[model samples]
Target: MKILIVEDEPELLKVMSVFLEREQYVVERATDYASGLSKIANYTYDCILLDVMLPGGSGISLLRALRDMGKLDSVIVVSAKDAVEDKVQGLELGADDYLAKPFHLSELLARIKTVIRRNNQHREQALEFKNVKLFPEDRKLLVNELEVCLNRKEYDLFYYFMIRPGKLVPKTALAEAVWGDSADQADSLDFIYSQIKNLRKKLKDSHAEIDFQAVYGIGYKLM
Candidate 1:
């Protein structure tokens, strides 16, 4: 899972990042509202940890902005303000969950899990595409009930493909989605081709009833 932590408190931010990383989450940090907003604009996250107070702007305003952008289901409010009014406002403004200060980290983790479980459209931890199953939490792929070990890039390729089943994904789009800004200077498309090749091999080996096709003058399509 990917989580964005938008807390200005240095100590608390570090602690939260350490704990969540240990739990196998890809944790990203943003110390202030603008930084957090940039992250929200650029990347897709499974969840966001937002603070009410920040150096430049209030978390409430940030949440409101995200809500306007139709991102309410992806945010959790974490604040030191424990007032009833604050909690009500956050919930009303579209926070999935609220965690007050001085709470246990374990409690926060559990709350994250609960919010994700409630918000998940798939109804489970595993996402299904035809005959393949991709488990986001475990980072595992299974076909016909048999596990298929995959390399890092191969796993990422299949994950994106499954999420966009039957869709044509351009090589540049996939490169940018996976490598972010670094893909701007990518000299060759060989790396992406190699990963796709490996992913196709693994799926076929596992007896997956899916086909990865190269579209002429385009990119790839999972069918």
Candidate 2:
């Protein structure tokens, strides 16, 4: 899964990034309000760790902006200001949870997992499409109660698809979401094609009812 940390404290940011990376998450960082807003506007994340006091603005403003944009990305406000009103304001603005500074990294991990689990469950049957089931927290996939083991890239690819279901997903969006900033340097989308081919075969082997319908020169839609 991916997480965005909007924090200005260099040490705290580094520690959090290193710890989350060790836990096998794709971590992205923004030091201040502008970059945070830009990323929130352009990308989708499993969760966001928002610092209440930002370099250029208040994290409350960012949270409001996110909800205003109608994006449901999970947010956990991590800040030194642990006043009752601060927590209340953050939650009222749609933050999923709040953590004060001086928190244990392990506690943060647990909170992240909790929020993500809650978000996925709230996403209508844990993002099920037909007979297929995807457990994002476990990185597990099931078809007809049979488990299908996928490589890292394949899981990432299908996760994106499972979330969107029948909707057409652009290839560029897929690359950016799955491969992050590295997708911008790709010479071609051949890698995406390869991943899709593998996932399709796996689904067929597992007797999954869903299949990918490629839109020539465009992207793919689950059919």
Candidate 3:
């Protein structure tokens, strides 16, 4: 899972990043509101740890902008002990959870899991197309009841395609989903075509009933 920690405290941010990394989450950090907003605007995450007080602006403002953009990333507002009103307002603005400072990291971790789990409950349903069966929770894929070995990028590409079924997925969208914020810095999106090419070969070798078909100068669709 990917998580963004929007905190200003140097120590707390480092501690949170290290702990979450040990727990196997990909973590990113932003120390102030401007950077936090930029991160959310450019990329997506499974959850965001937002601090109520930021150097440049209020984290509550960032939260509002995030929701205003129609981004549904699960958010947990982090605030100081006396900032009760901020916490309340954050919840009103659609924050999934909240934590007061001087809080237990364990409790914070629990809340993160709770919110992410609640949000992703709908994805628990296995996705199947033709002979391919994908179990999202298990991160496993099978074709004709046989496991299909896939590298990390290949699996990510396949999952993105499987979720939309026959819908055309633009290369830019694919890059953003797979590469996250790094997509913005990429010289070109040709890397996406290469990743898709490899994934297609794997599925074809496995006799997958569904295939990714290119629509010259446009994108690709599963058919």
Candidate 4:
């Protein structure tokens, strides 16, 4: 899973990023409104932790901008302001949940999971593609009704492909999704090649019905 934390508090931002990274999530941080808006404009995330009060602009306005773009990334308003009106405005603008300041990290994590689950409810708890089944919450995969053991990166890569079955997934996008913002600093996509090679071998060895087909000078597509 990938998460973006739009917070101005240095300590809190570090804490949230560290905790979510420990939970196996690719976490990106934006300290103020401008940077947060830029991230919203450029990248995508499974969930966004937005702080209502920001240095350059209000998070409420940022929320409005997100709605205008029609991006349905699950958002949780993390603000010091606990006013009912504020909550109403945020919910009205399309926030999935709200977390007040001085909150427990455990509760924040729980809320993040809940919001993501709710957003993906249409797909149910498990994602299915041909004979492959992936339980996101449990981080498990099954093929032909038998469990397939996958390491963390393998599962993340396969899950990304599973959700967008048959769609062309660019190598850059795949790297960013699995490796997070740091992927941009890499000199080459050799690491991605290594992971994909192993993933393809595993799928073939398991006799899976679906497979990844390279798109020639582009990327791969699950077919």
**Candidate 2 lDDT by residue in tens digits, 1-223:** 7899999999999999999988877788999999999989988888999998898898899999999999999999987745677789999999999998889999999999999888874455456888999887778999998899998778888988987888999998888878775575788988899999999999999999999999999899997
User: Candidate 3 lDDT (Cα, whole model)?
Assistant: 0.85
Error of 4 at 18 (Å): 1.0
TM-score of 4: 0.94
TM for candidate 2 is 0.87
- TM-scores for every predicted model: 0.81, 0.87, 0.82, 0.94
Cα lDDT tens digits for candidate 4, 1-223: 8899999989989999999988989899998899999989888889999998899999999999998999999999987745677688999999999888889989988999899988974468788888988899899988898888899899889888988899999988998889986686788887877998998888888888988899877889999
**In candidate 4, which residue pairs clash?**
none
lDDT of 2: 0.88
lDDT of 2 at 34: 97
Cα lDDT, all candidates = 0.80, 0.88, 0.85, 0.89
Model 3, residue 60: displacement in angstroms? 1.4
Q: Report lDDT (Cα) of residue 168, candidate 2.
A: 97
- Which has the greatest TM-score? 4
- For model 3, residues 55-154, the per-residue Cα lDDT tens digits are 9999999999999999999999999888889989999999999899889889988998889878874555678888899876666899998888876777
lDDT of 1 by residue, 5-108 (tens): 99998999999999987786668789988887777776666788988888899888888888777764478888775566767888999889888888899998
Candidates 1 and 4: which is better by lDDT? 4
Error of 3 at 154 (Å): 2.4
